[model samples]
Target: MITLLQNGAYLLNNSEIIEANNEAEAILKSKGVVETKEEAKQNTMAYNILKEHNTSGNMEKLEIKFDKITSHDITFVGIIQTARASGMEKFPLPYVLTNCHNSLCAVGGTINEDDHMFGLTAAQKYGGVYVPLHQAVIHQFAREMLATCGGMILGSDSHTRYGSLGTMAIGEGGGELAKQLLNQTYDVNMPGIVAVYMEGTPSYGVGPQDVALAIIGAVFNNGYVKNKVMEFVGPGIKNLSAEFRIGVDVMTTETTCLSSIWKTDEKIKEFYDIHGRIGDYKEIAPGACSYYDGVIKVDLGAIKPMIAMPFHPSNAYPIADVKANLKDYLHECEERAKVSFGDKIEYSLMDKIIDGNLYVEQGIIAGCAGGTFENICDAADILKKSDGIGSDKFTLSIYPSSTPVQMELIKNGVYATLMEKGAVMKTAFCGPCFGAGDTPSNNAFSIRHVTRNFPNREGSKVQNGQIASVALMDAKSVAATAANKGFLAGADEMEGVDFTKPKYYFDKSIYETRVFDSKGVADSSAELVFGPNIKDWPSMTALTDDLMLKVVSEIHDPVTTTDELIPSGETSSYRSNPLGLAEFTLSRRDPEYVGRAKDVYAMEVERREGKAPAGELADAYDKVKKQFPDADAVNTALGSTIYAVKPGDGSAREQAASCQKVLGAWANIAQEYATKRYRSNMINWGMIPFLYEKENLPFELNDYIYIPGIRKAIEEKADKIKAYVVGDAMTEFEISIGELTDDERKIILAGCLINYNNTSK
Candidate 1:
């Protein structure tokens, strides 16, 4: 269904693809295209949008100032706190704070609602927009209110994509948002653009999630589009609706791309018209000749209803194949669970099989991906044609992405149709997508149309011997499976079903009545509100001349995600309290990580108090002193670090790295980072993003690695750093950090982004 080009190709008037091979020049000459490859590269839609936002006046290296920025409750509290510490008097641009992820006040008493109140007060004091709880998710609100043609938006959530609306939006960590609030630029190198050439239309039952999964499956494992911009072009641009393209666009984050933009048409303009923002719509397309670094050609007609099996969104398979080989597929999922869980719980999908047919307990269609108006309406049509979902163990829940979408659904009768078919309708909340709401029973299986399906993401604690898994599917398939009374089924299996494609009616009154919009006017006299759960950041010291780091955790997993590093669900309420949230660091992947890091932190505390470290730490310091006589307790900072094969795979939550920093972590040694956002999080938190490429390490867990002249190396931009393992004997190993901007270097020297900004003030 998806094919990746092996060589760079040129699009001729957005119609024909001419591969840039030895004979490419001759082919281009015949078509009256005379631009060279280097000149043609700037003709892409991504390059044009980027050039408009870039303040550095250089394409090779970019310093971007976004048009707008947004955050949700799980992240807004920390972002605003960081900005306040950095001497930010008011928001420099349009900022939207949406209370979606932590909207549920069920956990941690009043913590969730307290954050919402704080958001409202901050918006008023700082002159920003505040969308009330249950009004809308972050991305949905951004799409309806903030997205504009050729505009750029930065959000503190990972799935922040509005390319289908002709906007290049990026989802980054909270630190980036804080920088923007301080009127700082986002620094990076120019990203490559990949063309997603589409042709034909999708089959009857195939949804946008199916097309997205097929593309992700082809590109994720091979790093085809990693850190690149996906520019949608060709005939396929005209075949999909605005919402269908949006559904596909949001899932592009799973492929690890930096951002995305698309060729716009009247359909996109109509979307703006429907939302009463027609002025924001404009046509965008490639020039006569444009070059792409790579191309992913999608055959929409060939795409089947797909299911991304447990543990990852990239492990995709056709529903037909999975149903044919039920036993084999279940066994594969079991094996993958063992790798992730490591015998912590007895996990099994075999019992879910009844009479050789796979069965699931629950189905959810929620969050930004599946909660859109188009996906939910199509699902409602499918459910209306079948017997209601039975009352046994099978259940279904539908959550609209925003109150506006819910209101239209109510008027259009889509909500009643779904409710009549035994589907529970919930308000706009992102809790189910990130493990806060609708947690299933132990060993239960659920099918969702959400962003991710990582382990423990469904709110089942592996530490408590509770294991539940989620598989990602399109909303139509989930509705069909619910109609089957829990038996595995795809929407394609339902014959003669009329999919009454409904027209969406946008309602702005729902938001105008409840949301708090400051209209970019700050109130200097407004008092800030604070709850007991909200706390300021703890003090952090600058980098020392030399360093001694203990390896607290060693993870050999092929990839380590942010959820495994700090976890979600119950811990989300503590995001605003830095020290409080640090306690859950690595709680899911390594239960002992917190205690081990705390022990090293205690030693550092003693050293800071002018006392020598006791026991093994003292012995390790003594061994380090034997080689470097100048390395003393005063000069050498003591901290902890972790070694992983590849870290920072999923989620743009800054807590993954900040939690490590709060627990006295000084560095992370990894072969390579999975996403650019994660590495930026580490740099902003004052942790070294060390690159150790060797298969075998010179140190193990609990071993100390001492680096001499660490501060000098960072200041000098040394390509290679020398560190010694303080074991039975001092063994030396080389480590290096990849390219860093001058500002990034200053941030590390000053301890963190907050301190860096403080020094500037």
Candidate 2:
């Protein structure tokens, strides 16, 4: 149902496809044509919007007026702590903190709830919005209450997608939100625009998950939509509802897309009207002559029920194929499980496929993508007739996306129908997706309808030697699998049940009644509360003239997600405290990472205190003195740790970048960055987002690399950089940096984004 282009291809005259073999050739050949990636990458929709709202009077650095800022339980603590350290008083914008991820408070010694209570008190004092636990997930609350037409919102969650409702939403790290609270425009050079050409209606049983997975699989590996806006268009716009579009839109984050927008229609108008925000509806379409850097064509009808095997959303295949070729697919899953689960536990799927039936241990339909009204109603339709024919080994659970969606499901009897068939309904929570709730048994297998299936994300404590795994599936297929007594079955196999196209009845009364709405008022008298676990960001030093680094850890895996870097479950409680949270950096992937990083951090501390680095390194330091000869002029700065790899991907968590910064990491060396958000995270934390274009690196892990004239490079805005790797003798390498805004250059020079803002203030 999908076609992969072998090389970069250009959309000629908006209709034809002509391949562009290389970026350089494409750029030189298509100088004025604007028909390929090479021509369009330099100019993008984000850049255009930025130029129009250039309050800073600069083309590179932007100063924007956002309607609001938002964060969730996972991010609020960190953002608030960072802002407080930068001498924040009251919130300057409407900052909303919703309790959804850490609301469980079932673990971590009262730290999670303490963060929530702190949010409530801060809301009352600083005049911000606070949604209490069990109210709604962060993105749902944003969609229901905060999103408005033509407005811009900055959020800390990577899944902060609301373009379908007309608001241009960005999912960034907490540092970005902290910038907005400090009245700084989100600094970006603008993102390229990709026209997501949608055509053909999805056949019944092929839900939003099917369509979403299809698009993700097509683009993710090739980075087609990375750091770009996916503008949806074509005749297929009339085929789906707003919620269906939203289901697909939210999953775009997995593709590493910067943001997404869709052609608005009556369906969107109806959504706004139902929410009593008809005034928020506006017709937004691409200009008839609007140019796109790339075009992603999706044939919805050809989409099949897909399942993303454990560890990532991109490892997708047709459900029918897995069922038809059970043994081969089971072996593939087993091999994958071996890589993900390691020796923590022995997992086997081939044994579960008994008598040509794939027996799933558990099934879940939950989170932002799966818990919507349409998805649940369709699932209920499939399960309404099954009289628990599935074996006792199979269990099912459903979570409505929001309380309002729950109330509507009850009004429409969708919940009753689902519950009648041995399904447990859950509150609006993000736990199942992030390993907080619905933990599977040891060696158990679960099929879920959630955003990601990253390692240990299903609540498996891999570090402690326990492993349970999850495979992502659409809600309809999970229902079908459960109905068949754990025998894997695609939704297409379900012969007859009719699923009515239900109209969503949005009732904003719950939020209006319970949520604290500040309406953009800054209450200066509000005293911020601090939890015991909450702590300020550690002091960071400016870039050193010559740098030395120990790689600490090396991950040769094709992709290393942010979850694997710092983890998501218990470590979440320490997010407010940079050092405390940094302790978990690479804790799961590399058990020795923390101790190694701490050792390096101590060296930096000693140097910062005007003493020579202590221990065995003193001899090495003394030897280095002979090269520069002057104590003050040779090397002015010192940091002990750095992580280098092929790539850093997934999640907008600043912790991924901040953890390294706190651990005394001076820089990250990589072949390329997976997303702008990840790179921005590195920059905001005062770490060099360094790049080397060589097909191979001349260094290994723990190899100390030194960058000379680094501080001067920032002052001069030099794109070409020079560095030396510290070994028995110094080895030099060439590195390049993309263009940086003047403000960004200052931020790097001043140590970090917070330090930069503070110095200016």
Candidate 3:
């Protein structure tokens, strides 16, 4: 069980919680505590780590410079392209581009492989490191090689958390990394630190996923850790293994937290030693009476086998509870399907129920969260002990997080045991986690230990009339379910279970044999190869004096994931090409989004070419022009926009925003952004992020919303701007921005990160 404090709280060294309102009295009574709040603030584990990295003189406004950075194949191409456009000559620090996401290379013919080759050449030309396919997942490699005690790392992947190793790692948009690469600091106001206070030990059959899912299910919807650093510190830190801490830490991405750090110990030191980086270990712990902006108390002993039903990782429930209420839970999933996939096709999981027990067709333990050495070893043992794990209709696959982990699994006979038990083994690939590999049959159900189980994330294309559901479970339960012949079952229910971990041997030869290391020396003379599919980014116009945006899509979902905005799976191969990838923007969520946005985009093309708008676009422009007779068509920029209740819930992929940018999207109006990464992606892509709370909007889909003096408003740092929703007639509503750093304002005015950098020169 987990309990979230209603407000910020102070944490005593002995795992005692004190509410923020009583901080003064509690500190006074506490031993070895500072009298002032400022002094007490510096006592936190996060504070010590942050102060060491904070380059800005002011603690209130932090400007961070990361020690290292990383990216995967799905992202590195675009990031390199933007950096090249922004005048990047060479990588300033160690930059690793791991080709794990698109390792399959099944879609778009040679495009995927082209991206990989491009990454290799870029690393050679730009003084970076390159990890080949099946070498390692992004974060796992970072943990093994890049992470250092009391250091900071920035990665483009969303699940970049290495706090368990005493490193403060953050996942952000490529623009943030591009900034760091270009010798600019990551600017932000100091985020609040939330203490995840753990006590007691985990029960049998309970894995890190269970604890992580419990935490995510509890904090996700409420925005408890939104945009805040989650500093995990408690007496229970000693109870879990280093691998267990990592499993839980990786899933912190689902909590929508800014970043995470944990109190380090000998267990973490051993992890560094095992990875051949003993020098990276540094003892890290909070001081007595540390002040936290908030607190999350986790009693690990109460955690049980968990499952997150289709559509999201946050839609979690205990496996036992779900079995007892199968029909009701199944119906709940179906109802959720209505919101996520719409009524285009009938979706159901009730058919998967056989003999009053739920059944799944497939099981997967893959990617950063699931594909750990311990998780896979436990899974192999579970399957090895059981009489039969799978049948003709049921299949199980496991992917080790890194080549070193896989090498150890093979050395310890875990790999042989898994194969003997009918579980297929795969190389280190992130494919299954993001819909690139392990695609299921239509309407089939799969249970996975991947980071997310979002709709269509299982690799089925909903827009193409194929649908599948994925339920998240720990590797133990996934193995248990497999051993049950696809029947949903918890690992605890099985008898004579072995939880012992095998000794892991990390093989450096695996990487030294295959990985490309430029050794921080750029080969400037080497010619950069460009595939025909890897097209250059189209020139984006700067913010105009006046803006006319047609609301192309109106999504009323409580939260919209980035996957829905830009689908994963096959569409991901085209991520390198801006215009090619833009075609698939909002394809799954709103099929007509592309056509509608293009209709609006056409006018923008015309405006850029000094041509007149025609048809519906002209009609709408005429109506808006009547409001301001002096408004010239040449001065007013024509573009598209979308409105959603809450958008940007999943993935740190900047493509979610870049795809829209390529399609001429000028703004995104939302009740609130689901994550800071998505919102920052929008800003870096040079679009206005508008916050609106109007119950009755004067605009309908395809209706034009005009903002006059938009560029001037951005230049003046105006919080509220005058705007009109023009349907049949003009109606005014106030549109506003949440907050914009000075650099962010400049980026918007310059059109995007690339533009901003180029113009700054």
Top-TM-score candidate index: 1
Shift in Å, residue 8, candidate 2? 9.5
Q: Mind giving the per-residue lDDT tens digits that candidate 3 earns over 332-370? A: 999999987777888878888899999888999998999
> Where is model 3 more than 4 Å wrong at Cα?
22-27, 30-32
Mind giving the per-residue lDDT tens digits that candidate 2 earns over 544-602?
66566666776655567788777887777788778888888887777788888788778
TM-score of each: 0.99, 0.92, 0.98
Q: Give lDDT for model 3.
A: 0.88
| TM-score of model 2 (CA atoms) | 0.92
- lDDT per residue, candidate 1, 1-761, as tens digits? 89999999999889888887899999888888889999899999999999999999999999999999999999999999999999999999999999999987878888888998999999999999999999998899999999999999999999999999999999999999999999899999999899999998999789999999999999999999999999999898798999999999999999999999999999999999999999999999999999999999999999999999998999999999999998899999999988889888888788888987889999999999999999999998888888899989988999999999999999999999999999999999888888988888888899999999988788668898888889999999998898888898988987777888888888899788898899999997888889899999888889999999999999998889899998998899999899999999999999999999999999999999999778998788788778877779898899999999999988999999999999999999999999999999999999999999998988999889999999999999999999999966799999999999999999998889999998877
Query: Which residue runs does candidate 1 get wrong by more than 4 Å?
Result: none
Q: Which predicted model would earn the best lDDT? A: 1
Ten contiguous residues minimizing lDDT sum, candidate 1: 621-630
Give the Cα-based TM-score of candidate 1 against the true structure.
Answer: 0.99
Write down the lDDT that model 2 would get.
0.77
Clashing pairs in 2: 47-190, 390-485, 391-485, 551-702
In order of TM-score, best first, we have 1, 3, 2
